[model samples]
Target chain A: MASFLRKNRPLLVTLLIVAAVLLWMTNRYEPKVTASILLSGLTLGALYFLVASGLSLIFGLMDVLNFAHGTLFMIGAYIGFTAYANPRLILNTLPFALALLGGAQAGRWLGGLLPARFKQRWQDSSFLVLTFLLALALLFIGVRGFNLEKLVAATATATGGVVATDLAQEAAGRFLPRIILLAVSGLFLGLGLSRVGTAEVRQRPRWTSAGVGLILVAAAFALIPIRTPGEVFLLSVSSNVRFVLALVIGLLAGAGLGALIESSLIRPLYGRVYYQLLLTLGLSYVGGELVKSVWGTVGFYMDIPAFFGGSGDNCPSPNLWSWFSDHCQSINVLGRPFPSYRLFIIALGLAMFIAIALLLQRTRLGIIIRAGVQDSEMVQALGINVRRVFTLVFAIGCGLAAVGGVAAAPFLGVNLGLGLEVQLQGFIAVVIGGMGNYVGSAVGALLVGLARAFGDQLVLSGIHLPWMDGVVRMSPSIARASTVLIMALVLLLRPAGLFGKKD
Target chain B: MTNILEVNAIHTFIGQFHILEGVSLTVPQGSITALLGRNGAGKTTTLRSIMGLNPPREGTILYAGEPIQGKTAYQIATRGIGYVPEYRAIFRALTVEENLRIAERSKGDLAKRGDLIFELFPDLKRFYRLPGGQLSGGQQQMLAIARALVPENQLLLVDEPSEGLAPIIIEAIVAALRQLAAHATVLLVEQNFRMASQLADRYYIVDDGQTVSSGQMADLVKDRPLIAKYLGAGYAGAGLVPAQSTTA
Candidate 1:
């Protein structure tokens, strides 16, 4: 018994602490309030886990501390919001996408036409510069060509002067020819870029990739009918389907952006930690500003899907078990009404955790990742291309963060500050749990979430200590600082974090 | 025999420190050529250079008659060369099975060599499910060598496999390498001159990042003065001659 206690001291201590907290909470507040607070804490923890898992995995494999990870989250929320509310905004921008693609392809073709001597001397830089110039010219022409006043007037006339969020759909049907042009340009661009990316590795890019891209573009065009009287707007689709579409679009956008950043920015700066930190930090700020410009400065709440029932304060059932049969904005949990979406967030977090764990444990790719974390050079010597793996891992990490953003959009509301806010908490959780340990990050996130929730409660209703006569009151700022305090305390006791190994 | 690997006047550097100034050597096909050198004599660096880990800046490495100096480590490894780094360098957190699985160049490579690996190092089979860190030092060295063999590499670079093992373990390793040499070429780095003389058919002595001498192992065993000069006086006095007949 003594040996067992000594061996499982940490686990025992954690259980003891949890019991003490629960006992203290039940004494101070009603069970319903306590249950609600704990559920909320779990919801927050789910969001943090979604962000931190990817952060931890990326850091473990690449030794890169990505400051722009939060930016990916912000982008996810914006993309999801756009997909949910105004997908036509994206479809309308295809011409601009085509212009950029055309410019890039033109630059590549020009580079290919260059003499071998000149090409060898300049390498791909000249092509990149030419691409940049051509893209700038295209952007200038596109801006000059787009008459916004005429578009707004046309939209107003089409919508009978009652312009709504779905205004862009009115113009979508006219861009069919442009869509075909974009698809063709995208095919050539995809082929050329794949060649550039895999030339060093000597991998031949299969036609299936281009075929898939074309099919997807064609499918998107088919799915959303071309300005038919009844089926013109994507918003006409069910809200739940749109929400699912948002999730998919957000994930793809985040992954694509991640791959681009890794191949272009992070690849050249490997082994230069400070430079990478600087670059990513600068990118986060740029990303935040870009989001503000695109989505506007003010935050907005996304409407709950119809599957969860219409948004209102009406409660038909008071029993927690009734949630399974009834669809309501809020569900009764232990006599307290809690947002059912928060429960969904909690479920998503747990699901993501299990999925990530399975991916890391059961797959062949997982073995390579675990081995790469220990010694990448040795992994490379074993015949695996670590660079491609790095890019793939980075993309996966960003995709996970984006998923978190989409999940958080309904509960927390979409905003520019959301990314950085969750990112800070995610970093704290990672530090507290132990850098590069995903399970530890999850636990750390839960701890932080619980601390924040309880701290907020304490500030609202001052805690009464057994030793003290009166209720001990403190400033509300203490609640905000509670996570840092817990982090500091954990660091003081276990410097490498709860799960981190000492170097 | 035709050379499988030839290093010509390679100059290697690790973060601006010139480690291998003018190291050069050639390994004949199907032979276990031992690289004999003292500590910090760039013997390990020479192996790393051929593996394209720390690629040499001023030399050409011809592998199977093709230059591979500018290639990445993975690219060179895919060309059928395997490396067993000094001190094992096994992924400690991973299981023994996982370590071998990650080293496989093609799918089912491990399954193809499972019998051969277990036949050579039966202890690895016993510890297949256990983490590499849980294994003993000698077991880790076995796992590391076993990892290199999973890909059916044409050439194997074994660096200081006997560095931290007992005499019994070293004997087992030497026997395994003797068997391995019949199927693949090997470039072995060893401080144990006796082990080198026993397993190797030819030997090269590296001192101060340069190959000072090259000859048959029998000739090297006879040259006590050369051993005393390049290796320390301690090695020469420690009965550096082979205890048994050298492997062909």
Candidate 2:
């Protein structure tokens, strides 16, 4: 059948088109179902992109599997939180930027701090021992300083800023350097955009700067004092208060730092190693250790202040969550009102998705990245600074992850392991999408996400099987199983990935 | 008249097995010099050590009077020295254009020099768009040499340049070597004696990891009968080599 379909290309195409349309019609949506599916998929897919990208590059370029990449994603988020909350640290936009930069620099310096002979001999596998040893040492230290009593919480930002979606309270004269938040967001965008092989960038962004710029601003706002319209700025920060600017700054800083790391440490370090895949394991462990050092494993999500922050969950949120539970004004369209929360989240995700798509498709950086994905050695040979492009690609990937982290924080629990599970999925998505193809990854993510959602959701309540694993009772989503299935299918059918040219 | 490169009494070891023991050779400016040796006699290993792809345990490899015994291949390349390794290390996954690009880092533009290389091997020009891997052995060898060329190349270390080339291709290579000698210096390690004899200005022979013969290419020509005695070929009757040359 496979050979027949392959030979009869036009017949195959017609059958595929018919099947797609039929499937689409069968899965028609009401707002709530659509939105819930969309939200989970976006957050999940974004997380995968974040973790898998690093893993892929580590393996694809260097050939390192990095069994520990999940740990690194967790670590980066923790670092973002710690940098935001800690005192006597670099404050404000610029300072926050520096802290993130420092973290990444530290990762690189530590990652590369290996003996010459060992590095030459072990190559990528070399990092496994060197980094694992360093991580184990740090782990020993961590156990001494902060004992592991795991506190499980969703969306726990490091500074203890709990997710509260009350628009009225948020605007009720709590924090006003709205420009700073905008600046931080702008900086996040900039950090994401500034990557040499940027997918797409705003030509004249209102708030576009490096992580350092955002950090300095966050610090200045926190420490320097800002007297804006009906807003009180305090020097002594509260134990359970929200540093809105800090989170924003942290995102920007983390993004930039991630970029620098991609270039200075990753490219050169892996260049020496023989099997690039093992780089992931080293990077993951290093990331885990770094996170453990900063946050000490007790996740915190507290309130910043009532005026600049929301007093309660009832207060309503301007962020997507609020737009969902409170803000989305229900309207009668065709005499039926759709579930508002699902619609808003879905829309927000769609907008971001479209924007990302355009960024990858319609920009010069995107073109180079897409091309470089297939042929990096050639790109360098063409007088393009391939090293710089690699760094930028990494930064952009990190920045996207950060954005997804913040946006999805309200929906899922934001803890160390948030990016971990999805990281592997990202690899699967990229692989299923055909390793380096951007459009293919997106489609693959959605397909995988939807499949998982369906697998988890679809159930015959009336019929009960007495003997089944706990997962069946706990909603067995294909999310966990889908990756392996997809990978196996790809291996058997399209080993090169969906969009990949056969090597 | 000036020695571009000089290796003096170099000794190399690969895990205790001594290779290139007491080996010495010199490369003169704007001229071809051949380092001839049997398999496992450490000709390729010497080139690798010179490029810092391998470090020698004992010896001095001096390039332009600067002792460059320990430098990375990239660093060695940037220092006006291009090594066309014996294996033809053309980045297999990369296209011909990309292969040229990675090797394109001289003061002058690499594009202009590429033109001259293609002119020497017009077959490469005809299939310039193809991937380096797709090219035939001779084409890859040509691309490999073309990859090493620069407008003001201080020195070129070519390993087994004519090893597998056809007679016609070998002629083209010899002609190109002569042309390159009009400008850049060359250190050739050749297996084809005829090819080396036509192009080399000086010859150094290594037997069992030790230098056995050293003289001008012109001098070796007059002592043609000695090839059978020393190298086990060419010389007709007497076992001893004769010292005779038009220059002398």
Candidate 3:
């Protein structure tokens, strides 16, 4: 691991900081509570994996950066829900399956329907414009007629003149819209990943699928709207920062997502970096607007899952909002009670992560995927239609991302900017993981996750340092500043991402 | 005679360099015609154009007497013509068996014509387990010839079979070409005058994408200048008629 770190200097620096911060955060001694916090992290990471995987597969196979991958993912969700109108059906497994299949078929059809000039137009820089069109189309169609529910009619009508709405932030994030959005997202994730067998994508990444399944189970519970009881777990003796843990975990999660997105999508698009960046920006705008269209833009409200809900309390679980509701901790050196529940969620997240690792390494499918990833031609010569494999891999990747979204939505509250917000973090994770390396990607995800958590806490503890943007002169924000700064530094110090071997 | 393969003044351009400039050739019914040329000659380009892997910028390629210039490689391959590239372009990752399977003309192999290939190249039977990448130089040459034997026992475009092979293997290949000519029309591209003179029934010596020399095998073997200028050697001891071998 140390040698691995040395080879991946940028990843190393990130890992050390992240690990140190996680250790520091946990030092508060919320023993029983750490599990749930980790679980929360894992859930969030899973969703990132879904999107990152698709982007990764596309980039690896086609040598094209899908700047609008997130938008496509989001579109899958919309199409799925369009097929199945029941909000409750999105919650049920059978309905979700049907919708997911429908959505994936739509994606495949759309994929095939892409201009016959795909070889020429899709290969050039102008491809970004196409992505922008796709994103814009999805947002316009998805958001405008979401409540209209006439499925084909709304999507096909094209010119359902924009509803004159003066609604802003506080007015949007409501009950019905949030539920609909959640179902749409789940269906999208499932559909995106449905290509495992059909697409022959990267030889069926097993770990990602298993991890996705586990995450789905967790999300199903989260989406249950059912009440569950909880108990106070073991306490610690440290009088340290409880809120500090919350802020740290939040910021770190954000940073990791940012990193993963950058490397998987943004990094490889450097040749057409302008197009990718522009596409990301355009898609992000669409995503934000879509969110605004759903709820009214105030604050999202969803019933907490039984796992997070308090014991027999009418109101859902009550713990610090910082980390996921894992357990309460004994440490409080900084004046706030350490969040035991959120810490537990993080622990769950870690366990979920281990599942992902085991799935990637120990499976036959994984072996085939590894071979295909290295040299697809070698695998294709074996009579496997590699194109189908690519499609499956992309779908699986997208599924993992959707799982992450559903799992994280409870804590972060799914918003329009949520995909883009975490998009950069995912890119950061890719850099941390090392470019295109599976183990590297996981390691990178962890390091960036912990780093962001630490950086956020560090900033709050009387650190008045102004951070730089990714480039020397670029502007920066507290939330985005550290991630971009770290990425820029990593890129400069080592061209290959920290954990990545030189290709 | 019904010409099995015909190239009518075909021209080809790779990027900017004009290579196949109005070159034409014909393989008479069931005859082994040698496409002889020096290095940097357009023999390879002509084969490529005829196979439709590289389309002629201006001209027509008639196969079994049909215009097949603009067809895809697979389309051409499907239409009873098998091309063995100069580089021995075997699917390297595939085992020798798999490579054969891919090339095994699904439609044509059913007829006992394929048995003739195994009889000709029994060495392929011995090293059948090995991957195409692991084959020795001689074995690969045999495999390249065997690969063309598929598709259809109709028209085989064997490019430079005696190229860089040992004399022993060349002799074996010569014997196989002798057998092959009985069933299929053979278009053999060769630099080795001795091998071409022994196997080919007719000669079309191409240089710089133009047919520089053309005649019967008897005529080509007797003309010492033809041998010296085009083939780099002369028929000394053996009479041109006796050396004809009647092999191809």
Sort by DockQ, best first: what order?
Answer: 1, 2, 3
Q: Runs in model 3 with CA error above 4 Å?
A: A1-70, A77-503, B104-153, B160-184, B191-198, B221-224, B227-248
DockQ winner between 1 and 3, please give it.
1
In candidate 2, stretches whose alpha carbon ends up further than 4 angstroms from where it belongs are A1-43, A79-286, A289-293, A296-411, A429-477, A492-503, B13-17, B92-95, B106-108, B111-115, B123-129, B218-248
Q: Best candidate per TM-score, number?
A: 1
Ranked by TM-score, the better of candidates 1 and 2 is 1
lDDT of 2 at B246: 14
Structural similarity to truth (TM-score) of each candidate:
0.90, 0.61, 0.49
> Which number leads on lDDT?
1
Residues A275-394, model 1: lDDT tens digits: 999999999999999887666677767777765653444463465466556667788777777888788888989998999889889998888888888899999999898988999989
Instruction: Please tell me what DockQ candidate 1 reaches.
Output: 0.68
Predict model 3's lDDT versus the native: 0.54
Model 3, residue A260: distance off in Å is 28
* lDDT (10s digit) by residue, model 3, range A1-503: 87775655664566577677568557743543344344434544555554554455445543545555554444333323222221221222222333332333343333433454653445354554554455345434434433322322222221222122112111223323433433344434333333222211212233444444445434434543321110001012111222222223333333333434443344344347567768666756675565455333553322233333444321232434532343223222133343333444455445545664565455534434554655554334223444445545554555445445544444565445556656667767676455666655655555455445444444444343238333232222553566667667777877776655565
